[model samples]
Target: MIRVVLTDIEGTTSSLSFVHDVLFPYAEEHIGEFIKNGFSDNPEIQEQLEAVAEESGVSANDLDGLIEVLQTWIREDRKETPLKMLQGMLWEQGYQSGAFRGHVYSDAAEALRSWHDRGLRLYVYSSGSVKAQKLIFGHSECGDLTPYFSGYFDTRVGLKRDPESYRNILDQIGVAPDTVLFLSDVEAELEAAETVGMRTALLVREGPLPETSRPVMRDFDEVDALLRKR
Candidate 1:
């Protein structure tokens, strides 16, 4: 039986355009100023900046240089932890300002509620920071669907492509790997979850299916049906 459902945010529960067009641009536009106007003085922001400095071999005190590196990472959509953390902080400001509500697909919104009601635990595992995950769901179009989730996982556990990450999630959730179902748009992420003995499903929103052995799901209803059969 599938006791837990681990889902990816972008391309799984939300649209890719929302991330690329909306979220990324907002972060890119505001990040330089956000760092310049003394927000960098916050201890947490300072810590992440230090991390970025260490990774990029730049000096932490060189704020302008660090901001330039961050802008490059944002443009490339790199999955660096510090970049994600900074993005999350910027997104929090966006969400609070009513700039945009997080986009959750209608199908995902409905199915997630149904699954939560059915006594299945739902969790989110995304490359985005855990705070970002909560912010998205907490301000979702579905109206604060954050209550549906049992937990959230971010790169802090490990990269989603690493099998050990899924293993760590299983351990943290206190569920057998076989009893967890992992859903993602990326085949590599699904493969990693499968390698850790978790059941996996691919969310193919469009285009030709990738060359993968995992079952492809067009929507959450299909996933719900599969769970019912199990």
Candidate 2:
């Protein structure tokens, strides 16, 4: 019955090390410079700068203070919209400059192609901004995967841990919740998706699997198996 596959990016389709080790560090390294020089080039940069100022209770004129605050947010991996937007902008630079290609698992890329070929719609829902999500897939290690996805959702819709977010996605997709399979590495996210009546799967790639009542999948191949049963 599943017609749409809604997936998380960081730990589901890609490795956690890539996010925590490579992307975060790259963003932390370049964000300050990006903010300082980016405002004049793109109005969106200025907009996010103002947003960072407003959210952090810092003065708009205080660029250094804002940059410091943003770096801190990067270190903490805080899922704030302003931080995510800024990070996305910085990541776009990294991706385009050939600093690093986005790391997507081989299984994920193959399954995604297989799923799309099977006529199932694919979508991405991640804490990263929509722009960031696209850049990752667009310049992925497996070449461009952006063409495989039908749509993308970021924190702008809502946090993944909120059931209303799943409801919002379900509403936008215009499908019954049960017909969408939500894939994520976080148990809370899966629980939230289930709260909205969506089919949920736990994607655990490394470390010990959490004690989840929901079906746990090693990789996208297992997800293939799960989807076939329905």
Candidate 3:
């Protein structure tokens, strides 16, 4: 039985354009000012800077160059830990400043709340940083969906396409892999999860399947049905 459901945000429960066109650009526009004003003093920023340097093969002394590199990473939607963290920080300002609220599909919000009520452990596994995950849910259009989740995980745990990551999360949760259902828009991510013995569902939310055949659903309602049948 599926006891836990882990969902991806962008392109899974949310529109990809919302993240790429809205969230990302907002971060890019204000990141320079945010960083220049010593936002790096934030513990999260400091940690991410170190991570970014390691990922970019650059040094801290090259902040300007690193910023440029990060912009490129954002454009490419690279799942670099550092870039994801920085995006979280930039998003924090946006969320707090009332720039833009997190976008969540109404169906997603409804299903998530219902699933939580049913006592199914819900977790998030996004390429987005954990902070970003919290921010999106906490400031979500549905309002503070974070409390509904049992935990949040990001790329820090492992690459989404690497089965080892799913294995690690399963180990951490102390659950039988078959009881854990992982929802994502990417076939590779689902493939990895399945490899680790977890149940997988493709969220075909107004997009093409992830270039591979796998169990697929248009939304959480279908997922709920699948789980019920189990």
Candidate 4:
């Protein structure tokens, strides 16, 4: 009786090439200038900077060092909260300046809408910041799909591989763990969700994983079948 479906974005509901090849490069190209010229004085920006400094036990005044650290985090695709927040801020400027719209697969958009209409509780769980999640769907190619989500979560809560994060999400949604279906391309993420007693499915868009830890499917069509079985 899966009532809630939590989906990952980068490589599950959308394409990995879009995230790695397109979005990441766009952010990398614009980040420096965006940080220098955009609203760094914004309260959210200041808060995240302070958080980064606190986490690293470094001085917030060290702007150059901070920028260097952030750039390194970007290269590694680290799920550091500060890096995610900064990326979201930089992406905001890119979105508003008509630089590029966030990418969403047509299949994803259509399936999400159909699922929502069928009364399934849809949520997003991504390493990307919650703001980034909203920005992606809000400016999606299919157009403003934010309304389809019941909630959004990011690494600010906890690391994706930590079972406690899935526990927290289940608690927040007030649903029985088994009734929540977690969808992600990463096996570890699914492992964490299953640890929290949630149903799990691997989105195998990137090809077969080295180890088949759970039920693997090529696309949402297979996932649709699995959901229908319940």
TM-score of each: 0.97, 0.98, 0.93, 0.93
- The superposed Cα distance between candidate 2 and the true structure at residue 20, in angstroms, equals 1.0
Least accurate 10 contiguous residues by lDDT in model 4: 32-41
Poorly placed runs, candidate 4 (over 4 Å): 38-40, 209-213
Ranking of predictions according to TM-score: 2, 1, 3, 4
Which regions of candidate 3 deviate over 4 angstroms? Answer: 207-213
Could you give me the TM-score of model 1 versus the true structure? 0.97
Pitting candidate 1 against candidate 4, the one with the higher lDDT is: 1
Residue ranges of candidate 2 with Cα displaced over 4 Å: none
Model 4 Cα lDDT, one tens digit per residue, 113-154: 888998999999999999889998998778999999999999
Q: Candidate 3: deviation at residue 83, Å?
A: 1.1
Supply candidate 2's per-residue lDDT for 1.
97
Give the candidate order by descending lDDT.
2, 1, 3, 4
What shift in Å separates residue 48 of candidate 2 from its native position after superposition?
0.6
lDDT of 4: 0.84
Error of 1 at 91 (Å): 0.5
RMSD (CA, Å), candidate 4 to true, equals 1.7
RMSD of each: 1.1, 0.9, 1.8, 1.7
Q: Distance from true position, residue 144, model 3, in Å?
A: 1.5
